[model samples]
Target: MAINILLTDTSSPLGIGLRNKFESTTFRFVAEHPAELSWRDESQVREYLAEVKPHLVLNTIGWGEGTAIKPDLLADGAECLGRCLAGSSASVLHLSSYRIFHGEGKVSHTEADVPKAASDLSKAFAQAESAILGALPSSLVLRSSWVLSTEGGSLLARLLADFEAGRSTVISEHWRGTPVMVSDVVRAVYAVTQQIIYGANNWGVMHFGSSDVCSESVFAHKIQDMVQAETGRLLQLEAIETETDNSAVLEVRRLRDCFGLQPRSWRQGLRPAVRRWLDRRGLLAEVDSAVVEND
Candidate 1:
């Protein structure tokens, strides 16, 4: 029997990528749009859960850009969903960000470290995690940083747009993060979900991302280099020093030890991610021709 999975927030990049990932799998996927669902209302959530009867719930409610929902509302929705799922057999895999921790120096944050909510967004994320775990102790909260994809308003998409429009890309030198491709995130999600389906009791928090970390400027320059190499177009990149230096690097040892999942460098996915971004905009052919001509 195929495991029924309910995926919330189907409009986000992570949601889109996850849907694509599960298309060929044995899991039966059901998508729920964020606009259609009210997370804060317990009765509504309970009715939806009873209707869907999902064996696994992938809650990705407010992890995207341009989300109109307030932070408190998002947290409330998570708590409500958790409470609703408390007596049910369905397992939850919630998405979170590494922004919950304010990294000190080069230290990678472990799951044992307390999440330092430095900003409002981080505070909301922490609260959501607590609410879900408190409501459902078996729930898994996966924290990642710098999620990049070809679709939506991801950092990679914005950089590609800036380069295509001949706009100078401004990057901060002080901000550092571990960039992970959305596809890799999907891989981790699938692996963990499958383990859960197989009756593995490992739950709570896990951090997953690329092994290496770099500043925003370095990441932007790497993207610029790949674009220039492929399409023979180099856009001006301006690196500005910021007053605050914040690093969000996640320690992935727990994910590896628990799930036996290995981390891949974000650089490994950069070229293909860039190519996909170009292909989406109908510019891949031009890039291919440019490369061929140069050869």
Candidate 2:
């Protein structure tokens, strides 16, 4: 027979990418717009599982993709998942953010380390992660950082949209982070899910985001440069102080120990994000037509 996998998330770039990455059969995907749908609602999720009977569940649903993370939603969602999947044995891979740590110094975060979250969302994500991990040992927690999808629908989308609209942004000069491409994160999610189910790897929290970590200002400038080169528009970026309360370099020993996977650098992922955004923007039209289309 064929293998069945379910990709769960709200309407984020990475969430959308998951469906696209696993569009072909043998690697069937079950996806829903978690932003509109309540994955926290046990009855709803159970219904989805019943319908899909997925061998593995990749949960990309969270509030922090573009919006500031919400504490209530995080807690409630986990409470719901605990009740809903209390019995089902489907292995789960919960996608998390690099914001879980909020201090200084370059230190690698492992699956065993208790993270100090940087924001409200990260804190709640931490809570939910604890709850889910406690309930399901087979569950895998994927702690990732900044993820770029060049389209104007995700974090990259917001940044690019701001730049295209001639808005100046003040990026944190001190706050640096790893940025994973939507494609890379999705690929890792799928790979970890596969390893857990077929390869029978014991589950735990893992770090599977980009290895390259940089400041928001640097990250923004790179994007600004790319768009400027492509559209001949300069983007203004101001630097601001940023802080981290967690380890700068996190250990991926557990992840490698389990599946021997290493993610791509954020730089490698940028070109694709730009291309996708340009495609979405329909930038290929003749200048006159492009003007007309805008008009």
Q: What would the per-residue lDDT of candidate 2 be over residues 1-295, giving only the tens digit for each residue?
A: 5666877664566667777777754676667544555766777777767878877777655545555455576667776776676677767777776666654244556666776665665577778887778777678777776666665234576677787677877677665566777788778776766666567666777776666677677778888777766666677776665454233345556777768897557788586568556656765335534654675
Collision count of model 2? 15
TM-score of each: 0.90, 0.83
- lDDT tens string, model 1, 179-215? 8888889999999988999988888899988988888
lDDT of each: 0.80, 0.67
Query: Backbone collision count in every prediction?
Result: 0, 15
Q: What is the lDDT of residue 88 in candidate 1?
A: 74
* Worst ten in a row by lDDT for model 2: 242-251
